[model samples]
Each structure stands twice: as C-alpha cells, then as structure tokens.
Target: MIFIEHILERPNKKPILIDLRHNESETQPIVIFCHGYKGYKDWGAWNLMADAIANAGFCVIKFNFSHNGGTMENPIDFPDLEAFGNNNYTKELEDLHGVVDWVQNEFKHDNHIDVSQISTIGHSRGGGIVLLHASEDSRIKRVITLASVCNFGKRSSTIGDLERWQKDGVKYVRNGRTNQDMPHYFQFYEDFKANEERLHIESAVKRLTIPTLIIHGNKDTSISMDEALNLYEWKPDSKLVIIENADHVFNTKQPWESDDLSPELKTVCEEITHFLKQSEV
Candidate 1:
C-alpha cells in the first residue's frame, strides 16, 4: 500500500497536509476527499473511511485545506485558528487544485493511478467546494457529496448578521465539540461576494457533465435533506442515497475510538464503493 502523509508546500501560501492510502502494486482510480468546515483529514472516522475506500481498490487521498485551522505539524485539530479565520472559498478551491496537481505527479513513475479516472467526494462545506471545482475542472470524472450544503451564499448571509459582521469586522461561531468560539473575519463573506459567480454551488451543479452522487442522512440536523433534494432536482440523473436515521456525520463522532467504523458509516462506505464501481463500468 502506498500509505503516506505529507504536507504539500506552495509558494507564499499555506501548505496542504494530505494523507494517501492505497495499494501501490496495481494501477487504480483516484478518489480525493475534501472535509467540511472545522474538519481535518483525520477527523472522526474519516481515516478509517478512507482506508475502507482504499481497500476497496481505489487510491484515496484526503487533505486538510491550507487554511482549515490545522497546520503541517499539527493537522488533527484547531491549532491555528488565525489561519482558519483567514480562510476563504477561493483559497479552498486553490488548495483542492494543488492537491490534484500533486497526486498527478506523485506516483507518475510507478503508474500507480490513472489520473484520467479521478473522482472526488466532499462533505458539507467541502461538498460545495468539490462541486464548484468539478464544474470547472474536466479532470474530475465523478463527484459525491455527503450531507452537503446546496447554497453557500444563503448559508453565510442574514441581513441582521451581515450588518453586525460588517460593523464588528468578524463573527464567532462556537464549535459545540471543541467549545472554542471560532472566528470568521468579514473577509470570508467578502471573498464569497467577490467570487460570487465562481463559488455558486447551484450554478456549478447545473454546469456539471459528469456523474454525481448525493448522500445524506435523513436525521441530519446540520444540513437538512432538502439540500440533497435540491442537488437531485438540479441534476435528475444524479444518484441520491438517504441513510435512515443517520445524523450529519452519519452517526460518527469526533475522537472515534473503536477500530471498527459505525454501522451507518460502514453502510455509507459500501454505497460509495458500489457507486464508484458501477460508474466505472
């Protein structure tokens, strides 16, 4: 297996910390995973989930975005809140591209993966990112979103909050799990405003030509089923999977201790693997 974890550095930019998992003996399809807001590569059961996918015969690459609060040295949790606060949609998009560029060259000599068969899976905020990128990047053959948000602009905007955010220059959202009041500088919204067209998930969804898989938990309180329905509606050909009674993270939690994945997450992995196999056929 080509199991490796390293930080991909960029000139005058935050580095992306990535984890690669797959068998190096055979050529495989590529699957890149993008984590959601306040999420890291090793968050919760993501590593196990990635391993499961990699074992199912695909090269899985998961990365923490350059400004996702984590660092090259400490990638698990919020060690660099300042970076997190400074993060923006355009920056995340650039980070995803950087990861893709790295993967294409990392094992070129061994021919470990067919770069042409690249696909991506994103969760929540990352889902939107993947959609936006796939709309523009022809290299991505398939796209999957887990409990994703359908609209970035709506999620970030509220007339009352906007005025307060503008006046205060920042906003704080408490991370229920970490108990930290994460700061969001007004630039987050400003960035969204500046790149409104490029960052619109709805527009991206409408423009995509490749296959899409929208997965959601019926009981997800963070991002409702309506969002998944919206994606399905926009692209009727897209496959939609609804996990009964599963929460936002599909019943998985941070600091997940068990060696085994949650029953719901296991089912999710099976669905993902199945989708990938059939899509290839």
Candidate 2:
C-alpha cells in the first residue's frame, strides 16, 4: 500500500492538509472523507479507518478543511484560532469543492484514482458540508454522513444568544478537550444568514438523488439520534444505520494510543466499505 501526505494549495484559499491511502493499483474507486467541526484528517482512529478502506481496495483521500484551525506546519490542534473563528458553512463547501476538483483533475491522473466512481463521507459538521456539496455537484456518486447535523441555522445559537452574539460581535465556545476558548466571529452568523437557503441542510438532503447512508451513535450527546432521523426522513430512500451504545465519536478519542481500530470504529469502517461496494455493483 502507498501512504502519502501533502498540502493542496489554492490562490486565495488556505492550504488543505490531505493524505492519500491505497494499494498500488492502476485504477481504483475513490473515497473522499471530510473531518467534522474541530476535527482534523488525522484525528483519533480516522487514519486507521482510511487504511482499512484502502486495504479493502479503494483509494481513500482524507483532508482537513482549510480554515479548521490547523496550520500547514501543524495539522493537528487549534494552532490557528483566528481562521477557526472566521470559518462558516459557505467556506467549508468551497473547500470541499476545491478538494473534489483537485481529485477529479490533478490528483486523479497522478495517483491512478478513478474520478468517475467518486464517493464522499463526512462526520458531524462535515456531514452537513458534504450533503450540501453532493446536492449541487453531480460528480459525487454516493454520500455517507456520520453523526451529521440536520439543521445548520439552529445549531449555532438560540434567539437570545444571537442577540448577545451580535452585540458582542463574537461568541466563545470552550473546547473541552483543548481548554481553549474558541471564538466565532459575528461574520460567521452573518454568512449563514446571507446564504441561509443555500446552507439549509434539509433542502440539500431532499434534493440529493444519490445513494445516501446516514450513520449515528444511539448514545451521541453532541448530535442526537434525532438528527439522523431527520436526515432519513429527508431522504426516505437512504439507508440509516444506528450503532448501539456508541457515542459522538463512536468510541474514538483524541490522542488515541492504539494502533488497532477501536471496536466501534471498526464497525463503522466495515459498514461503509459494504455500502460503497454495493454502490459499485
């Protein structure tokens, strides 16, 4: 198998940190993975998951969103909180688009990746970004969302909180793990309001015609199982898999110590591989 990590740089956009995994096949189906909010490509057991999928005979590309608080030199942790503060849904969509375009055009030819058989998977907030992208970009053939948020506008704040946020011009949410006060600039809210229709996750899910898979943990506290139910309801034809006793990260944690996949994440990777293979046939 081949494992390579590189930076994808664009003119005006922040450089994206990406890693590719695959056996040295002449051509193979491709999987593009998006990390969740406050998540990076190399988070926890995700690298193990990518390796498993690659060994299963698909080329997997996992990336960090450009403005996801990580710098090029340091791909993990909140090194660039300023960028993180300014991040919004629209920028994330553009970042995903840039990755897809790079995969289809530049990365495809160079890496022997099959552009025609592309599939995308996103976790948590990334799930919402992928849904919005797949709805508009016909290049994506299949979609899988893990603990994804159903409504973007509602997740940010309550009406009273919004008033306070606007008055303060920023809102701080503490990162329990990092112990850092993460700031969300008022522009983040302004961006969402300006493109509210475009950022509506339900509308995007409703328009998605591709084979969709929704996976969530029954015990998730960050995003409830109800969000998964909403996603399934929006696209009744999509498959919804509920992992029993799993939590938000599906038994995976940051600063992960094990080389082997955690039991729950292993199940997730297996289910995803099966879903992608079914789509292939």
Best-fitting candidate, scored by TM-score: 1
Q: Rate the local accuracy (lDDT) of all candidates.
A: 0.91, 0.91
Cα lDDT of model 1 by residue, 30-63, tens digit: 9999999999888999989999999999999999
Worst 10 residues of 1 by lDDT: 107-116
| Model 1 misplaced regions, further than 4 Å | none
Give the TM-scores of the predictions, in the order they appear. 0.97, 0.97
Residue 176 alpha-carbon offset, candidate 1, angstroms: 1.9
Question: How does residue 272 of candidate 1 score in lDDT?
Answer: 95
Q: Superposing all C-alpha atoms, what RMSD in Å does each candidate have to the true structure?
A: 1.1, 1.3
Model 2: per-residue Cα lDDT over 13-52, one tens digit each: 7899888888876777889999998899999889899999
Model 1 alpha-carbon miss at residue 262, Å = 1.0
